[model samples]
Target: MKISVFAITATTIVAVFAVSGSSPSAFAQVANRPVLVVSSGVADISTLDPDRATNVGDVGVVSEIFNGLARFAPGSADPKEIQPDLAEKWQTSADKKTWIFYLRKGVQFHGGYGEMKAADVVYSMRRAADPKRSSFAADFAMIDKVEALDDYTVRFTLKYPDSTFLGLVSNYHGGSIVSGAAAEKLGNKFGQSPIGTGPFVFSQLVTQQYLTLVANDTYFRGAPKLASITYRMILSDSARELAVSTGEIDLIGGKREQRWVKRAEGRGMNVDIFNPAEFRTLFLNRNIKPLDNLKVRQAIATVINVDEIVRYAGKDVAEKGCSVVPNGYLGGNCGSGGYTYDVARAKKLLADAGFPSGITLRSVVSNASAQQPIMQIIQAQLAQAGIKLDMEVVDHATYQAKSRRDQSALVFYGAARFPNADNWLREFYDSAASIGAPGAMSNFAHCSVADSDIRAARVEPDPLRQLMLWKQAQQKIHDDVCAVPLFGLKQVWAHGDRVRFGYELKGALNLQPPITELTTVTRSAP
Candidate 1:
């Protein structure tokens, strides 16, 4: 099991086989070349196919190699304004049920694959929607059909008016376009090794150690500045810090350790801090006892001091979170402010709900160092309320599997992207979102009331009316204690001074990195 890190960096570089020699001279010789070394904090690159990937770490890599029809510009805190990637421009019908897109010309897939066409976009959408593929298609479930009107023009028909349709299309995995022919030829292996029309091309996979990519001169947007990028898998956070400090690697991904963050800044290493519009929270399975009772759930939520946790996590590392809907989400009503840290109130609620002394609650947490503190703090707080929490920590893979099965009374996890309140409400409260389902994504709470309110918000298309509906949904979910919201994570990364890139403090880490905006900086003769 590797500790996965999520962030976006861009470049163009050629692939070169490293000579098998363990010496500083070998590394220093290559240091002059434009390269970024990342600790593959996570295991197996898994599927390079964005549509199939659920982990944020995987998406970070996928975003580099693939070009979506539309992309969230780097530094876009809001989802309403999306910049072009593959598509030059797009328009929506006045009724908001139809969409038309114009594809960029002269864009070719890596490896001289072929020219990108409108048919490819249509095929990709169909593939994403196919039941056999089983990607995160529910977000696009409202799309009734997709058709190529011309060589560069494509149209999308929706089942109903959806204001969030464009935002959904810009989703990390939702918007990745795969070649129709490649999908058929490679079958399942298509995910392991994907071909895209982006700035980088897949070169070689060296098992668990690392993956190598070369620059695509034929990239539609423009030629990438770097010649190559080597992603090294560094599982241990300490090892990653050491690698970055010692110059063994050029960059470190995801949130860095507090010690490393300070060290990197002190050393003049570029430290990018990004605040994603998402939060980590404790999800309560309503089917379970104690948590099933609204008062007990609310009491538990009120007892935790989020500000204290944020302070402990480190300054500029995290901010206080109020609700499932992130602060800037469209049509979102942020949940009530500040957790009321009242042990007396918690005790009374637990006792009133017949969950008094000797009541043991099970909490399933992911085996990550970052999450450990949160669990420990909650356990102590719950104990004071007369609730004994049995902490069960599992590896990431097992944690992800069990979470979907709803096997725990409580689960602590984070949503990678929460661009809109719909994502928040839909996953936690829709009937189809329940753990036991043909389309279950992450509704581990098994919250039926939340599901109803979320459904109502989804169907309401009027902007102001939709906001009202979403607010009601959030309030209802909060009032019912569907889940206890934690704090929003502030992403931190460490990189060597040689590399240059921009970081978006909101949305996904990459959006539009410096690679797309600047020329590659070549090493000057020292």
Candidate 2:
């Protein structure tokens, strides 16, 4: 297996719309205006409430319908580009534990939910802090309390100083503010019929079929150019390609493979490969069998080949990963060079751990288009050094259920977070987020070796010291062989030439080029 590192640059492949026969009446009646239809390889979004959103598919929809106190400047994933959204201005106390935000006046919520104010922000933050209410409740563990100082002013008192608090209030996850009145009225059904102050309003959802959104004419930024948007859930890659090629879809999530890129370009589709790449890692379950031994875990890590995995994923779509914290993130460090790949050393270590012959480990593998191929390549690579990986193929939902219950000895996971090391480290490596723990997240490794460094980095005031703490945590995790960092796969999407996204598409945190108030679709000359 050969290791190849590609430049971290956005690339284009040459990829707009005619509605399919099955499109709804809203899509048909918009002759004077354009209707943007988009397709992605997802069955459907699980929720519209931003607090409960656990994956990119749900966040993408929620982003269009909600506004946070702050937001990433459109078309950028960089944390430095964060700008004010519902909050016109904000300031923090001298200790950095208390933050204050002044809300923008006259920003109306959808469905007649009325204006957004400090009360809504307070209510939303409270909801986000409750474990039962939000998947990201642990993220708000730093907040001591949230209070409405006045109609337009909101204040947050944190338990400790957190450098990433600003991102927590930005437009990604729990930061997305929901209407207090609407949430209380709708109750559990609020996820289905969400109301917010974003540029788009949720119109309809048809289970596993599709979702529709209409332009919010009362949007704070201004009216969106497209009259409506049809977000269709097309899981089949062939069907999506056909739909986009036949003018049924203006944009479609693309495959992260070189062949797919060339094929889309051949069909005249404009392809966009953007950040932040979803970082993949193989987490070794310490509680499971032979993996309980540190030598066995180290042997497993030594046996696996990351270079082979990157080759299979294509250098254009994937970048070699070397840190427990993802590469290219703030406080990220890949300078340790990672563990050297040596099959002979792995076999020797396994023998020393009482596995003289070989050992078989079971993993629950998802049949999702993007995951199966990578897992298969890994299985073969592990077998080369006497580690047998028995993968139980299952549907994505089943895979999630089984993996959560600690059924897998090795968990292959991929995720992209707030472009900060704290977000990734705290969720995936912290002991508190270990599976089965209260308010558990995706800490599949049950790793606690770097808990002190991880916690200290959060409150470290000096920038240099803070980054050093983060690097120390990563080094500890790496030395412990808690997880084998694989590769970072960039997001791929194709759009029609007629679709003009008002800003240059550099990177989007939501995993899709956001359809904003500025985005427009040109109509054909009659």
Candidate 3:
């Protein structure tokens, strides 16, 4: 599909449309508006609902189509740079348990919905707090109440003081405010047809093919430079790279390998290797058979060489992950170091655990280019220590499902959160978040070794006390061998020379170079 550049006026309204596979060419007819066709390494999207966004593709699209009370400044992923969005300003009580936000009046929602108000904020916050409606319910577990003080004002009461409260309401994850009217009217269909007050409006989604979003002419931050964006699902790396090289697509998620980065640059494409890196870690399921033994878990950790993995991944795109909290995040405990890679130590540990001959571990792995290679390297390394890794290779979606269902003895997963220790520790290391728990999120290891430290760190008002608790939690997880922290793979993307993101690509919380209001495409370029 193709689109060209144009302008929107006060009298003009862009219509949101969806088409079936039969009408694949519908977007090609959009007269003068240019379309930025981006390629994601997924077969399709699961949902467009901001509250339930888990996949990187879904979050990237949701980031453009929605707005939270506060937002990380455009072109940067640093939490310290977060600024007001739908909310004009905010203040917290002396005890830091109560918060008040003043709304920006007259801001219109997409799809003819009425102006946003304090009630919508209250509704969205309450929706996020409900586990049935959100995958991020744990993020708001501390919230006691959210109320509309007036049409232009909203207030929040927390069960305990949290230094990371600002991040809980920022434009990431469940903090994205939904249109209360749209949520009520659309109901379950809201995921398919989302309406928010951002620079982009959801327009068309041709499943397995492309999802298109048109510009919001009445965007609070003014209109986007590009007329629209078409996120195309291209599962093949070589094919996607070819498409971008031939100018068939504006941008494509590049393979997370050093050679791939060099190859793209050689082809004269603009390669953006941005943060925060998805910290890759192999979690030994504490609930599983052999993995339940501490020596077995420590043996597995010792055999894996994170330094070799980083070298294989191309040092430019990967960093040695030192702790569970990841290196760049605030309150991260990287100074403590990680498991030393020693084949002899691994063999000794395995023998001490009563496995002198050999031991085999089953793991579900994603076949995506970014993951498959890393797993393969680990498998080879593990074999040297008489540890056989029986990897169940599956598609990314299937891998995620199986790992969460506790189907694998080992879960090798990677993710980039909001750059905070509490966010990572609470969701992955807390006992309340273990898989199969009543309100489970992503604790694939079924790990509870650091639950006390994680919990204590959250409400610890003393800055040093909180920091120490976070470090203690990480140290416990590491010493207990709950998971082996591997390497952090930075996001790799390549774009055509004609496209300009209008900002230096540094980091994006969505794990991609976000196409924002300032991003533009020179369609007339040869």
Q: Which candidate is the best by TM-score?
A: 3
1-526 in candidate 1: lDDT tens per residue?
A: 5543221123212213223221122112233345556664676576688678776557777777787788777655456557777888999889888999998887876544578899999988887776568467787788998999998999999988886666666636667877777877888888776877766666667677777665665665555666556778666877777677666676776443466577668866677776562467788888888677788787788677776676766667676676667655666566445457888888887778776663688877776666767788888877877778888888666777777777888888776554677876776667687888777778778766666557776777677777777877777777777777777766666676666654433445442232432334434454
- TM-scores of the models, in the order given: 0.88, 0.92, 0.94
What Cα-based lDDT does every candidate model obtain? 0.68, 0.85, 0.85
For model 1, how big is the CA root-mean-square deviation? 5.5
Candidate 2 per-residue C-alpha lDDT over 1-526 given as tens digits, one digit per residue, 9 for 90 to 100: 6531111001100001122222122223333556788887788878898888876678888999999999999899988888999999999998899999999999988867789988999999999989988889989989999999999999999998887788899988899899999899988998988988998778767787778777777888887887767788888999889888877688999998878988999999999999989999999998788888899999988878888778878878999897988888889998766778899999999999999898999999988877999999889878977899999999777788898999999999888998889889999999999999886899888999999999998878888999999999999999888899998999999988889899988888889998898887775664
For model 1, state the Cα shift of residue 427 in Å.
Answer: 1.9
lDDT of 2 at 285: 91
Q: Show the lowest summed lDDT stretch of 10 residues, model 1.
A: 20-29
